[model samples]
Target: MPRKRYAEDLSVEELRLLLIEKQRARRQKRLEHFRRSGRLVVVDDHPTQPPLETLASRPLSEETPPATANPKHTRLDRLLLAIEILAVLGLAFVLLNGFTLIRDLNREVVAMINQPTLTPTPAITAIVLPGGHTPPNSPGGPRPNDAEIPEHLRPVMLSLPELPTPTPSVEQAIRIQIPAIKVDAPVVQGDGWEQLKKGVGQRLGTPNPGQRGNIVLSAHNDIFGEIFRDLDKLKPGDQVILYSNQRAYVYIVQQTQIVEPTRVEVMAPTQEPIVTLISCYPYMVDNQRIVVTARLQE
Candidate 1:
């Protein structure tokens, strides 16, 4: 048998003649098939045959139906789309974490400033002289019993003179002077973001000047004036002078450390009067905190 040719390969005249012959042959075959099966076929009395010119007049539409997409390519495209969505979500999560970290750091600073101060009642001190004269709370009076004196009170009674803790009605921190680090900024009674914007903030609930407890003063290292920018330069024996209550309370730097922000122990109370200065670590990137601890000079 000869190889069959498609409509695209046939001329207009040939295609037209071929279709007419094929239609007649199809009718004859249908008639013979129905007779063999003994089935009566109903034929139209006036069969309206379509015009043969239509075959050559209008070429078969070249616009074929679209082919189905490949399953492998479709699956690969879907996987790529899923990966892109996941990447976008991951980027959003990281940005959210960064924002949260900055916000929480600011909130922590503000909370430290707004915290209420807990005032301790003045301790009663009754001392007896050599002549059995009981003086009313005289710090200068000679203490008799060395064994009876509390460890905290021993230094004040024997060597260092008693320095009274300042009791200001309102929270007021005048000035902070760290000559070693070249820091001489006005002090404010807050560690809040807004307060720190003005100057260094003194944390509430800490000891006052000359008091026998930890005095925490914290400020920003990179932003909001960067008051404690050179705080890391401070070392042992460096003097940190805080002028308040018309008196200068000098503190000798004992040690400096870089600690996590969650380390609240750095701000805990102490038996002896001390000063703790805190700032964000690593210069511009504030991921950790730098703490400088100092004790009051006698």
Candidate 2:
């Protein structure tokens, strides 16, 4: 046998030539076997080698060892992934809170819309027609005309407590001037007993001056300045001037009537703008009512 040559002792050029010759021999042997078996042979440019030996023999730059992850880089990637997950979870929480807030607001608005509205109803001020009074220049001071009230209702009317008068407003009837009757007097808010004692008292539920409803005003014919003493003298076409804070409203007298005290229908609301003046009829005798109806001048 020839002397054995170690791989380490061989020159670089000689080793390269030896590796090429070995590869050529292996390819020729494989080709001969395939030819004998009548099979097609595919040759590889780089022949297979032991995996560990191939990797050890290659230069460090060429090997690339599957690019094992760096410890610092792996930890940084894990941290970034955790931060992204937290960001998604935080966005979801904010969206859920916003949705809950909107749903609550909608419920509150619906509840408010479905709530019932309350309308103010005027209080009942008197039991019977207003302006009832005792005869003028009587022995006792002017008292409620119990004779005018029905016998069965007198006790109830007498027992009724006085109500507080409402504060005067600019829209209410403040004064009245009747040219035919030569009457000029201040107008107050309520037609209750105490209210009529001051001056002319407007019925509680009547409309204000010049409005499209009955404006009922009352005063004692025999007492309380006897403001409506000459109401009967007023004739149709006569002017009844009513004043508010803003301006004066002239109402033309339509008619006058003497009705039983129980005829409260005269004070009922009217479709047109009208004013109703009321007082006890027949001067000193206070059993019936004298109503003067007037329409607002156009």
Candidate 3:
């Protein structure tokens, strides 16, 4: 009631010492309270947990987790799953299409073999030529039924036979004179019948004088600009005479074609007899072949 004078009312150095003592007393009181309420926690220099004083500062609701579940991880997960599914589908589709194409090609080859073509086709005349005697209606033949012939049957060579037996030559076979076609080049019987022979084909066989299969005879039309000089002038009705052995063999022109050199199938032998003469096409290009199909007449 009167003026109080204790450490609390003293100077700063004395007040700090007094505050420490007061804090110790208050901590003892709290320990007593906790022990009585069965909430006492053991104290050690390095305690397993922080003092209850620190925990008391935070709200109980905040310290603990919420009642709801956690949010999920997504977005990139969905994109990756979709990409995997699409890749599987694309691979399946490609395999299915590839198998289908192979089956179709095999079917086409089988169908080709099954279809028989013995008689000459008027439209496709090289495989089997127009047969029998040329009527009077036919060009270069005697008067017969010239006007009555169908337009499609205008001109065709008779089918070729297997390679004919080499007849005795009236002169050397080396000197083949095709008077109708007027090709007076000497016949050189070898792989090189002509200068362009070496690099033009796949099959390089031993060329016998009288042999079966297609006989490919090639020459440059512009050799010194005079070889096959008369080849382009040949008409369908014109003739190509091969003088071989003692007998002279005659060939009538059937079909003429200008095609890329890659089409080597033209050199394949036909069921019928055929002679194919080939040379570079056009005025200056060597990429295409000018093919002429002919058959022996006599």
Index of the highest-TM-score prediction: 2
lDDT of 1 by residue, 217-274 (tens): 8877665566787888988999999887568888999999987654656776678999
Cα lDDT of model 3 by residue, 118-184, tens digit: 7653233233111112222335642222233345545532342223334434542344444555676
* lDDT score at residue 276, model 3, on the 0-100 scale: 70
User: How much is the lDDT of residue 1 in candidate 3?
Assistant: 81
lDDT of 2: 0.82
User: Could you tell me how far off, in angstroms, the CA of residue 220 lies in candidate 2 after the best superposition?
Assistant: 1.7
Rate residue 171 of model 2 by lDDT. 84
Candidate number achieving the greatest lDDT relative to the actual structure: 2
In candidate 2, clashing pairs total 0
User: If ranked by TM-score, best first, what sequence of candidates would result?
Assistant: 2, 1, 3
Higher-lDDT candidate of 1 and 3: 1
- Backbone clash count, each prediction separately: 0, 0, 9
What TM-score do all the candidates reach, one by one? 0.43, 0.54, 0.37
lDDT (tens digit, per residue) of candidate 2 on 1-298: 9999999989976676566567667977997798689895557756675554454465545634577789999999999999999999999999999999999999999999999996555344455678887786677967877777778877876787765555667888899999877889998888878888899988776888889989999998877788888888888999999999989999999999988888777777678999999998889978788898999999
The order by descending lDDT is 2, 1, 3
